[model samples]
Target chain A: MHGLFKWSSKWWPGVIPLVIFWGIAAWTSTATVEGDLAARSNAALKDTVLDKRRISVDGRDVTFAANAFSEDGRVSAVASVEAVPGVRLVNDETRLVPEAKPFVWSAERDVVRVTLGGNSPLPSSRSKLMEAAKANLGGVEVVDQMGLARGAPLRFDSATALLLDQIGKLKDGRITLTDTKVNLSGMARELGGREAIAAALKNLPEGYSVAVNDIRAPPYVFQAYKDPVALTLTLTGYVPDNNVHAAVVAAAGRKFFSEKVVDNLKASIGAPSGFAAAVVPALGALSRLSTGTLVVSDREVKLSGDALHDAAANQIRGGLGRDFPQGWQYKAEISVKPASAPVDATVCQQLFAELLSKGRIRFESGRADIVSDSAGLLDRLIETAMRCPTVNIEIAGHTDGDGDEAANQTLSEKRAQAVMDYLVRAGLPASRFLPVGYGSTQPLAGNDTEDGKAQNRRIEFVVK
Target chain B: MAALATFFWGWLLTAALLGFGMGWIAVVHRAQAVSKAWMRWLALLAAALVAASFTRIVPGRFGYWLDLFLVMFALYLCGCAIGSWLRDWVVTRSTLAARAAKSAQNDNL
Candidate 1:
């Protein structure tokens, strides 16, 4: 043992990281598979939307009894049948509901995007818009609005959203469109400062400074980094000025613990129990946090910031910190804020059984590929798309800073493209889908740790 | 890992022996010991690689960490080994010729 120790002292300073890398690689390598083939074609399924159908059930014909038909080949509709429980050989026609098509469903016929920037309307404004679009995106079809509204100037929310969308699509970290209302998130102080966020916001259409308040210190000072993040703390009540340095360090450790937990949950907690299990350990430092409420469960776990007294029973799961293997923020919020928040009740029952997790399907690290676990959630999205007939989708991808800027850009684009491919394969109109990638320039969450990174690597759906 | 051992172990051992021999020569002849010092570094790295492979069979989390450290060091040492070997070779060749010429010239004197 002494000899071994001597050997280690002389030659093995990197053993721990290598082992960790090896173990994690082993655990996650099993996670990837050669494309888990979505049934290529749904020929067996029926698509009878707008097509007339006559069916017989139990030797009896049922005509027009609240009939249902879908154009997507996956979903099957059954004839409605109400029969007495004890009756034998009752004549009833009930069709199986058709499997939903993997695409975005649109409800409106005319979804128009009016871009005000570079809006020098030509002699023919309608054709000009189409020409401008065709120059950038060839073969994209647009239905002409019979009477189009005059394009308005890009300002506030509109400009911010457009710029934010652009910033989100820039994989190389240079494409930025900043606004005061727009907030760029996700960064660890150790790697770089908040300058990237500031830089992103600076490039907006004159007079818009993006918001970076999320990383700044609170007014009363619940948490403060002594000299910007090498040390930080979140103490209850107030900071004792005399022991500020030590107190901050303790708080930072707490914060780090909680942040890691949140990120882990954000990444893969498709179930309520899994969310609780992922979050409990991070909360130990936040003693005041007793009853944690899960605001959103299923594939996406948007934890609620509520007290123990107001915690939801099944929604608040506990003891998942064992798998955290990372750190977090101090004095973490117990649940999502606001009592009136809409909490999905389905997740509390079966965590992995995702009903609506499309909101937070994150792409994996340094790549555009959706995580393996995203299949079920993405499938649900495809089903919803099939049900909604006329909608067009913008498959937008986002990333957090943890790699080379160029790589981040490529990954973001690739991820969006992946979603597009999935939707098209699922029988959505190829023309209806748009794929775009936003690198680490735009962030919904802080990009400082494992947790924040997980939150930032996500895709959004804008119904057009 | 097994391949790394077979691939790099002999060269590393040779570097270690060359380094030890050079150190003795440098101290006796007032020559620089830079080449020798680097050779020892290579030997230590080779030893690390040998130690790191134990992770494949080792139990416990701590062992895993240890294995990582060992592998990194072994790889680093291996990188230094080739350069160190060439340096030692150059030094020994120059010193041997110098000693032989000096002895021959002294005999004539």
Candidate 2:
């Protein structure tokens, strides 16, 4: 065994060929895997679509061909295929089932389309079919060709398009008319039944006769009842640091304008712009909003940050004016709320606590320049101001005793004014601001330790 | 459970292989001069500490102090792998070393 081990060591050079062979084997195996990966990455799901016709896909290529017209019947399936493994491409297009085109009948509107049939209605049946189509399909239009009867001119009502929108609420599965004699085809529930259907049909003066078809029966006709005049709107926005949310709900409270400008718009004569300025238009929309409320949830949107905040505010104002270009079809609802508010007692308390934790605002020794690291905290405060345009802001600066009381007062006032300038540039009304300096007189914390001193040299928001 | 076990095995094998290979190189330094390689490994250890501590990979909640704990765990695994590999290398070289020693002795005698 020892001799063999020695021989194995001496003949180790002979194993060079074996090592080379193993290297080649490993390389070949690796190449095979690489090829598999390439194939998987490149492989595409072949599509063989049959949309009333035939479409075949091989990799990225598509081939479309149609077979003798109607033999495939109504091809209703919009089936798509995806690539599986191993096989590069696979598709089956040999056989396909024919679909049926069912006659669409409006049992309540008293209309039905014989789109695929070849038969004409009698003169008496002509008006009956037209009437059926009219009473059944709302504003969608009613056409009765009466089976290729040249120039029969299928009479239709354009109002059919807007009628069925209300029937969506009727719990009764069906509505039956027996007077002019017609059947309404829809699933109505028990909550609103035959009497409700009668009430709905009572107001239709649009040149048509409709009546109760039956009092009780399953698989019966149903009128899809619809409510004509009802709509809803929602409001969302940010508030300012010191702003308070008003609890007044601005709804369509007996306030309808006698003077309307360019449709769906009614405004007071007291608008800053003659009801047509960009601002006036937005204000006009805000007025038309039949209902509004203010809420302060964490709107984690970028509405409170940099250019994004301005962009968000612009989007809010701009969206109001154009929420409905076709005119406020239904009584419009609107809300113009703030981002955050310190003028709000509750929010101010929370914000104060937040600032307290961020190492109470301080200054650089005896200098009036604000410290650098606390810039982020100031940035957040500024962002809060940008959110609520409804409230006025006051920057009250304070200090701890070290210098002459008068000089301290002057420095505190300058510091307060500096913050105001930043806010004004950042887009706040200067008229809505004031700066006050409290020099060493009012300290929320003690003046003994560094921490207490830091707390004393601070600023806060007081609502105007 | 089986898939998870397989994943654990894969991680273990990769770590073991890395440690085994590095351990052999470290041991071979005992036979030859490889001060630069030793320093490079030492630098890698320091780098692992810094990367794990401040690089946000471990996260603030985990705290940076556990960096030494993780490093020690890694070193222990590496040492075991290196020790095992060294044992194997010695076993494999024993007969050859013996043969070389005998041939050289015969020539001298």
Candidate 3:
């Protein structure tokens, strides 16, 4: 036993060095092989959307772990790794990305920005969706909160692109895609925006359908403002078409009798039912006011201003709603204009003289139809007449001598009556004014030049 | 678990064999006996190591190494106890058999 121990001691020290040398050699070889396999595997999956890739090698065996977006992608990744030249056996720890049973995605819009949320099947698809949103929504801010996933329906990109187009038409709303079904709800940006979106949705990709579309159109509005100072009824906002627009202008001309109709209205497609019928009465209510604004939005008529008198205001408040079509609403915030201080007949005469000196009352050619150009002058005259409520006044009219004496006299009388009719319509008592005509005899200027003739044809207000 | 065993069996078996050889040599050669106080301290130390490993109070890759070392150590200690018991049984049986043989020779004489 002693001789055996003496012989073993000499070899034992050499064995330690040999064991360590082999250990290091084995470690270096394993590391080199693992690094090489990892590089090859990474190259195989570089173009694919595999996440959290890890590769380890024991001799030629490989353990590959990654998150793959689809079962096919997972299998393909494993197969590719196994196909690598040095790989003997593959330990597959590859799992599919989380599958959304009813894959839901949404784009929501608020006042400031739009947010896109839910899952996307591929990174490329996610990037495409982001680009589409930014391109379609103009300068609006876009936020992306989408996750990578599997089980997205076929043609998802096509369907999502179509829905994103609809989102651009919304002022504020949300559009959701669950699998191949779509749900949309929100207010449209313009009058015809809702219909436009509905029409566009018809072009959605095949196998896609609308589940719930509750998009609401903006109110179809028509607005008019009566400015007593400007003597203009400004027509603004939208009209149904050119015909309705012209009709509305004509109605304003007749009802507002004394104000120039400044037509600022645009022709548009979405006017509510009974829009023309509703607007005529709303303009009538506005015309009864000393100054007022009328807004016809959708099926509602809102009139606000001061009427010429307490009786007019009360009449407007009580009667405007009754004149509107059924299923339409009316709101009148009517108040009476303050009555002017009473003035004597001399002061009333001076006020009328002062107003007429600024601008003369005008008539249309040879007819007694009062041209709207004289509306500002006539409104001031009526306001002056209103100050002397208890006094009597005579409106005298004279024509140029270019025509026959009898015809001139008849034209002058009709013009004088037109002036009196305007004042009476302005809530003045008809008995307070007497209209008279002179047949080119009472001329303030000569009968020679055009300017002279224009001056000679005049209407004067005299207090008694 | 099977993969872990396949990876670590070499190290664990080597540790157990080393412990068994040491235990067997100590029992057979009548080496200096360890005191109860030393045994208690070693047990406490092992318990502390187990606690640290289980709670993962140690950090980084070193913590993993410590856990693996503790497992190997526990197996080695189990092997040492079994080896010591086996050696004692073998020694006791041989001594009894030798005594019986000597008595049988005396009776034959």
State the C-alpha lDDT per candidate. 0.39, 0.40, 0.79
The i-RMS of every model, in angstroms, reads 22.2, 17.3, 11.3
Reference-based TM-score of each model: 0.20, 0.23, 0.63
Cα deviation at A228, candidate 1, in Å, is 47
Instruction: Determine the iRMS, in angstroms, of model 1.
Output: 22.2
Worst 10 residues of 3 chain A by lDDT: A3-12
Question: What's the best-to-worst order under DockQ?
Answer: 3, 1, 2
Better of 1 and 3 by DockQ: 3
Between candidates 1 and 2, name the one with more favorable lDDT: 2
Docking class of 1: incorrect
Model 2, residue A451: what's the lDDT?
74
Per-residue lDDT of model 1, residues A1-464, tens digit only: 33222222332322344345445533432122101100111111133331223332211112222123322321233221212111112122323233322211111111233232322212244355445444433343433332222232234333433343332222222222222234433321211223343444456665555544343211221212111122222223222233443434443343332122211111211122332333333333232222233222122323334432222211223423233433422223344223322223232212212333423564565656665334424544554454444656677777788888778888888888988886776556778778887888888778888888877877766555
DockQ of 2: 0.01
Q: Tens-digit lDDT track for model 2 on A376-442?
A: 3454555566545566767888887767999889888988887777567656788767888988889
True contacts kept of each: 0.03, 0.00, 0.00
* Each candidate's DockQ: 0.01, 0.01, 0.02
Model 1: residues with Cα > 4 Å off, grouped in runs:
A1-359, A362-364, B1-109
Error of 3 at A336 (Å): 2.5
- Model 1 TM-score relative to the real fold: 0.20
